[model samples]
Target chain A: MAITGVLRPGHAQIRVLDLEEGVKFYRDVLGLVDMGRDSQGRHYFKAWDERDHHSVLIRQADKTGIDLFGFKVDSEATLEKFEKDLQAYGVTTKRIPAGEMMNTGERVQFTLNNGHAIELYADKKDVGNGLGYHNPKPWGPDAERGIAPTRLDHALLAGGDLDQALDIFVNVLGFYLVEEVVAPDGMKIAVWLSCSNKTHDIAFLRHAEDGKLHHVSFWLETWEKVLRAADIMSMNDVPVDIGPTRHGITRGATIYAWDRSGNRFETFSGGYPAYPDHAVITWPVEHLPEGLDYAQRKLHETFLTVFS
Target chain B: METQKGNTTSVMTEEAYEYVKITIAETGESFDCSTNESVLEGMRRLGKRGIPVGCRSGGCSVCKCQVVKGEYHQHRPMSTEYISKQELEENCVLTCCIKPKDNLEVKVIGKMHKNVCEK
Candidate 1:
């Protein structure tokens, strides 16, 4: 089976506030086998997957949001073909500097359908040799091995211009809209789009204000693994914000929890399949009478209005 | 969306009554609040109005807090679909969703308004 425009299941890319600290957490504490550090100290890690190089990359930055998410295609030819299709759709595309592309370890840059950033190239590094430098007195634990993640699942972004963003995603990137929720004033509030069969590989929320990455998703083996992970969190005394519920859009039962650092995480399983082709669906925004706000409606509680 | 005015309700039932002693870690101020109000609300009531809360719903994860001591009950279940169950069990409760079930103590985990201005 050749990879398509869709991201391989479980591939997630995130930005970290402190690169060095993130390395200690993911490598030393969690025990993820560190692939190696970039010249700038950007660290990469591979999970229990057969992919050549790192599945997750963390770069140090003062602020955090979706830095970039990469999708695996069958070959460079597939990537070039997708690029041409994007141009035909009137979506501007950029070639990444070879350096910035993960394994390429060189400069490379690319812009996707909705102006979302991407870096595509091939150069996975080795993980076992000098790559495994010992920071024995590392921050977390010596014996701690990160719970092997299956893959980097999805990325969620909060955008101000929902319609425009959705248009680029559908027309240019060849993604399908799975489901959406509308605001009472007839504005799109949230949308779930997919480039793969596992429900949605990406989701966008119309922020009441600006655009930013909301959160990211990672899929585990089963519902039991989700709960077992929850129990581990309980044993570690981490606070559980919400969960063990089914999502209305994906129909996937999942849990929302946070890590020690303030970032949010979702562990989900059994989401519905995506549309066969790139099917774009739009829902007009309209005001809901009284019990219409999905956030309040579904949860039956008043969410604090902090965006304004 | 309709720009509705904020409404306050004074109704209280025995089941909705839980007492919590909250200590603002940043300022070292302590106050008591009823279960009817959230931790952020309780902070507001105590005049330590520096906590920045947007999207009072658990969706934002902005009003995040670390439980220093005691158990707090969430008014409703949070969607693990966004945040993970592991994070919740680690004692990272959103102040907006949290209602005191006991005499609880908490620490605001994220950047506060005062911290933002200092820079």
Candidate 2:
């Protein structure tokens, strides 16, 4: 078995305009399982298959966007090592005590060059996915509710310095650039990266702004489920941004929609497998039409400009 | 639901408010949306929270609401994707810029539209 020091996207702390409404949208519409609220009034939710207590944390704020994106490390020692590595790299690192995030453990928080908060943690209470591990069924009743994604898949963020961010993620975090779109001037327009075998565990776009969230993506089981997610969004009156189509970048079926607070979230599924040894795929910035949406082949204006 | 005439109420102030009664179909809760503003603005100002407001510039249409019964004038909506022409012709309005011409009744489609969001 290979080492996955940084396991996966554990949680995303997102801001919503209203807590109750956010709860309604995330729980009833997005079909995530609510893990109860903390003293800070931050709400916790997890996809049906997630064993960790929560993968999505939302707090009510005057504005909409992300506060931090967290990845779970393999162990506490790995988390500590990453923190020290970040400090050695001249990045400021802070520690959030365990229990600060309810069932979550101590987190090493650091800010990226373009102003996005990132964190690594080693522990969180596993509240099993409703099904018992011994002779458990394939799915539960919760799986059929709302737009039930199987798990929190990845995040797409926008920031100005892709080179700096890439250095940190590759040198410090063990992520490999699987695919990238470059400008004629040799600047990276966007990057798709992976830590495990999946195409992209997280991605970033070159933007004029620092610390903007493009979208927090959830993994559905299949393309059919992606379509069902779009169906659920429409049934609930959620405003969609794009898709119910395929993305040319990851070859993933997707639907980008805004939660009630205007923050973008994606229901995504089906991307090709990626390996660390694979050659990095590149695209010209001019070909963003097919690089973005395959069938439409139209680069959406809002896709680039709208970020929370 | 049939449209019914509602008694007009107003509060005289530096920012005079036209009182339009709004009933949330999902919750059966009623509030005044008569700030002479977009239904989204009036909803916010009236302290009727939970209605999502995005790009208050009338872009993004995250605040689309269905008019159960009311009359109001609005400029061209930022996009017809959220509230389609058919829906608009059927009395749907964008909450970001809905100005209630009189006391009226309406339901919020911001969280609950009929079809599965696909046209």
Candidate 3:
């Protein structure tokens, strides 16, 4: 009963350098279940345990970055209500047909001031997680297939107008500011927002580049699992961006790595739960390194400068 | 004829090979593997399809295993972040980086699977 509007982050359409290689990487290395390709030639995948049809969509292109990110709303009424809310707030919105995405109903899409594409959808057919509701085994074969993350968790995006972006999410979408890093002059440099409870569902940073994707994170089950993910990265030669470390902001144990296309992804575990009534935590700009990597307490130049 | 550890495995170092016997503790499946490739590589060569795979290069730990009664070498450095020095001392090894240095009985000991809210 607590979550009534935005249920969770639903899907992200990402561009890759090569579709077949991306498919193999996502299917065999990352362990996402390939749901097959559409006439549009885009590949779709769902985490083994996700009930939704797909959470990641990749298409081959000259560049690599996110095209759009979507959230699942509770119902069609909520979808309509949000559309009206966005229009009332002076944001332009468009309706995409139900079948635009496989098994998905309809989506109301819009672009934030920072230029990141965002969407809200009411329905997607759920494909049970291979384990039936009654008398289910812990996992099936796909669970052991690759890096096998459970679902797409959250994404950190880079943009110039972080304040306007934060306002849109908090004021328009009913999200809460979970954490933020503020410059000494009192302007926020980065902000984490949550629609439901498990820490940040999406985050934004101040970057000169508009609509840059910092990383799309996947949740590992434990600190140990995050470590194992790091090992997998070494074995496969995935370029490790950072971690097998802990983040002071969310208390998440993490490892950031890149796919072949140069897109960043994270395997992390642990984040303290926050409620709407909880006070937001603020970190001074100088203390950002501690917030980004608690153990090292060093601001990684690459982390601050690089986004794909 | 068998090759022993502490000596040249073969005439060519790059292609040198060592023989190993692996036991899949979960399915009670056993097979002979080689040091020229990882236990994971051996599993695939033998059509053994149970152990998980990721980053086949050693960056992700989908193929973590444990040595029950023999010695092995990590061809690469494993992150202590995931497998602590203590766990490595306890005989856990990433199969992707694992190379048999002795006739060994290894167990697939990693406990990982898909989880809700885990992505």
Candidate 4:
């Protein structure tokens, strides 16, 4: 297989103001399958197509933001190798024991220069999508649920020190640069990196704040699913930041909205498949307005300033 | 008889609603805020565009502001991470979680303050 390490985004633990409200919004509106709550009063969920035990977790907290983002490594050996590679790269790593999170193996966690926590782990219980592996059905009941997305796609994190952060993902983690937006002075305003065939597995923005989350996006099957998400958000009164439009950067159809607790989430589809040998695409800062919203061609004011 | 009944219904509706005017300290923009809804909700409902609308709950701390004049009731807690207890005592509040008890003059203090005040 071409992809051998850092398989995909495994899970992200987000903090919400109210537990039940967060649960309803995620379960009903966002349409992730509920995997039930843990002993710590934290609830877990997985997208309809994910075979893992969970991909999203929520806990009640006074503040709101992502707690940690995790990537599933191909094997325990790859996890160990990355831990050593990160440490050798002058980045300190911490090993969180297995069972700390339900059905999760030991995790090698480290803090990025931007004050965000990133974790890598190799083991998690595989709970198959309702359709069995042999002679599987095309879809199931969960597919018909509210705005159900096939998978958790990518996240754009905002903070300073992106150059240093890029080193960790590119050099140590085996991710390749897919696209970037550059300032006139040649400073990179934003960068999208990928670890697999997806255009971007994660992206970063240059901002004054540390550990800021722009949005965690989910992948839909088509452009129609993205439009359906807009309808669902309107019906529920979810505050939409932008979209139901296309992004010139990845050419992905998108809609950015906030959860009940103000954390931004995206439902999107369509982006060209990326390969390691592909050339990196760059957009100048002046063209960012068109890059962000290709259809509207307006760089949303809130897109730059507001963040949880 | 129908005219009297309609007049009584209108009076009851007004009595049931309690609205307090809120003035933005920077722009002098004003809006009527109902006692039942947060200031951010009133601003959004009236399309005031005074403050950056955030989670209409206490969580994001995006709609943070300080009441420079008059009084209000905080419907929930503002995490000390954004506003300390001392700041809360000084009338600093998250507009999404506070309702004006009387006419108030508030200054936007959150990250998007420039969008509201400068504009």
* Every candidate's CA RMSD: 12.4, 11.5, 15.0, 6.0
Chain A TM-scores, per candidate, are: 0.74, 0.99, 0.98, 0.99
lDDT of 4: 0.84
- DockQ value of candidate 2: 0.05
Give the backbone clash total of model 4.
0
- DockQ (C-alpha based) per candidate is 0.05, 0.05, 0.02, 0.20
Q: Could you arrange the candidates by DockQ from highest to lowest?
A: 4, 1, 2, 3
Q: Please, what is the TM-score per model?
A: 0.62, 0.76, 0.73, 0.91
Better of 1 and 4 by lDDT: 4
For candidate 4, write residues A72-109 as lDDT tens digits.
99999999999999999999999999989999999999
Q: What share of the true interface contacts does each candidate keep?
A: 0.03, 0.00, 0.00, 0.23
Give the Cα RMSD of candidate 3. 15.0
For model 4, the docking class works out as incorrect
Total clashes for model 1: 53
Highest-TM-score candidate: 4
Superposed model 4: Cα runs more than 4 Å off: B1-16, B76-79, B112-119
Q: Highest lDDT, which number?
A: 4
Higher-scoring candidate on lDDT, 1 or 2: 2
Per-residue lDDT of A86-173 in model 2, one digit per residue for the tens?
Answer: 9999999999999999888999999998889999999999899999889999999999989989899999999999888899999999
Segments of candidate 3 deviating more than 4 angstroms: B1-119
Residue-by-residue lDDT tens digits, candidate 3, A1-308: 99978989999898776677678777877788999998898899998889899999998765567899999999999999999999999999999999989999999999987879999999999888889889999999987777888889999989899988898899888999999999989999999999988899999999887888888988777887787777766555465668889999888999887675656788878998879899999998999899999999998755775556
Q: What is the lDDT of residue A181 in candidate 2?
A: 95
Go through the candidates in order and give each one's C-alpha lDDT: 0.55, 0.79, 0.78, 0.84
